[model samples]
Target: MLILGTGDVRQVLDGAETEVVAAVRRAYLLHDQGRTALPHSVFLRFPDDPRNRIIGLPGYLGEDEPVAGIKWIASFPGNTAAGLERASAAVILNSMATGRPEALLEGSVISSRRTAASAALAAAVLASSVPETGVSLIGCGVIGFEILAYLRAVLPDLATVTVFDLDRSRAEAFAARCEARWPGLKTEVAASAEDALAAHRLVTLATTAATPHLSTDACRPGTLVLHVSLRDLTPESILAAVNVVDDADHVCRESTSLHLAEQHSGNRDFIAASIGSVLGAEEPYRRAEDRVTVFSPFGLGTLDLALADLVRRRAEPLGLGTRVPDFLPGPASGADG
Candidate 1:
């Protein structure tokens, strides 16, 4: 078995946003083509602490170099108070022929990048006509940072960013980082989430809110919202917009905004299309010029597997990961039993 740590994964993915985005696009296309197996993610929560959870997303990506894998990720929102990241994860890829684990990889980076790439791809497909000069981010965490990076990679015209966070200091810090990363970029720390949402046509909601806290009252008619946090927007907000999701069955669960919307309306009709479908359509998806469009992704497991496979391929040739010779017993060793 080969083990790749965070640094190894970072090295492999550095300056590879474009490639990661392509891999993510392919994964979504394959999924839309019914060439993938993606079971719903399993969430484990503690009775004492409902806000924290560890999720297991298992999936199979069927293509020329088929691979199956599971990503085990833990989300402890309180970790941020201790100056630690809110999420950490690990992924294991299994061989198809032997059904044995082939690689173990640090998955936080893979998870974040794949998620960012998915959002970027959706932006490119859904908001093709929308002006990309500026964007607004409601949360200023690691996910928010990665989303900005991926968005810049795909939308080179993106020049300004407006940000908001419950923690004003964090928002300021995020703005500073953005300015430092892109020298000429303009970063504004908004006074409120509503202000941020109203600042740009393209908006991202990546907060850690446990339940709905936002409405679309402040957004303009043509706003395109990337609901990455899943639970930030109210059900009414979700129903009011042209809803696009990664998977209807997946997102309409786990008390996501769409799930609440379903429960309130008692139907899934609000969802107009999935990201995969939008990407696979014969005609480019045309956004309503007079309605807000919300793209809510459930964080597909196949995306993680796809990127992990890419990392493995890159790291192997460079002799990066630590290879364990006897991670599993050989067939000869089992014969003795």
Candidate 2:
């Protein structure tokens, strides 16, 4: 088995934003063609602390280099209070030929990158006409930072970013980091979420809100919302937008904003199409000029498998990870003594 720590994974993916986006796009295409198996993510939540959860996402990708894996990730929002990351994860990839685990990887990086890549890809496909010069981010955490990075890679014209967070200090710090990372880019810390939402035509919601607290009233027409956090927008807001999700069945569960919209409207017809369908469409997807568009991805497990496979394949040639020859017991040599 191969063991890849966080540093190894990051080293493999650091300047590979475009490649990561392409991998995520392929995963979506495979899913659209029904070439992947993705089970619903299992959420384990503590009764004592409703804000925290551990999710198990298992999937199989049937691309040319077929692979299977499960990403076990935990989201403890309170971890930020201790100056730690709120989410941590690990991914185990299984060999398709032998059905044995082959690689263990640090997953939080993979998770965040895949997520950011998905959002960037969706923006390219769903909001092609939207301006690329400016964007608004409603969260200022690790995920938000990654989203900005991936977006900049895909949308090279991106120049200005407006960010808002519940914590003012965090937002300021995120702004500083952004400027330091990309010296030429401009970053602003919005005074409120509404200000951030209205600041640009491209908006990304990556907050940790457990319930709906925001609506689309603050947004400009033709705004493209990358709804990464899933729960930040209200049901009415979702229903009003041109909803495009990665997977309808997968996203419409879990009491996400889209799920709440389904509950409120008692139907899924509000959803215009899946991102996969848009990507695979013979004709380009067209939208009204004055309507809002929201891309709500459930964070597909297949994406993680695809990316983890990419990392493993890349790392193998460079000898970047630790190899454990005895990770799994070899077949019994004759009968046990």
Taking every candidate in turn, the Cα RMSD to the unseen true structure, in Å, is 1.1, 1.4
In model 2, the number of clashes is: 0
Per-residue CA lDDT of candidate 1, range 1-337, in tens? 9999999999999899999999999999999999999998999999989889999999999999898999999999999999899999999999999899999999999999998998898888897475679999999999999999999999989999999999999999999999989989999999998999899989999988999999988998888999999999999999999999988999999999999999999999999998888888899887988999999999999999999999999999999999999999866745454
Least accurate stretch of 10 residues (summed lDDT) in model 1?
328-337
Predictions in order: lDDT: 0.94, 0.93
In terms of lDDT, model 1 sits at 0.94
Each prediction's TM-score against the native? 0.98, 0.97
TM-score (C-alpha) between model 1 and the true structure:
0.98
1-337 per-residue lDDT for model 2 (tens digits): 9999999999999999989999999999999999999999999988789899999999999978798989999999999999899999999999999999999999999999999999998878775465569999999999999999999988878999999999999999999999999999999999989998999989999989999899989998888999999999999999999999999999999889999999999999999999988999998765556988999999999999999999999999998999999989989799878
Clashing pairs in 1: none
Off by over 4 Å in 1: 332-337
Q: Of the candidates shown, which would achieve the greatest TM-score relative to the real structure?
A: 1
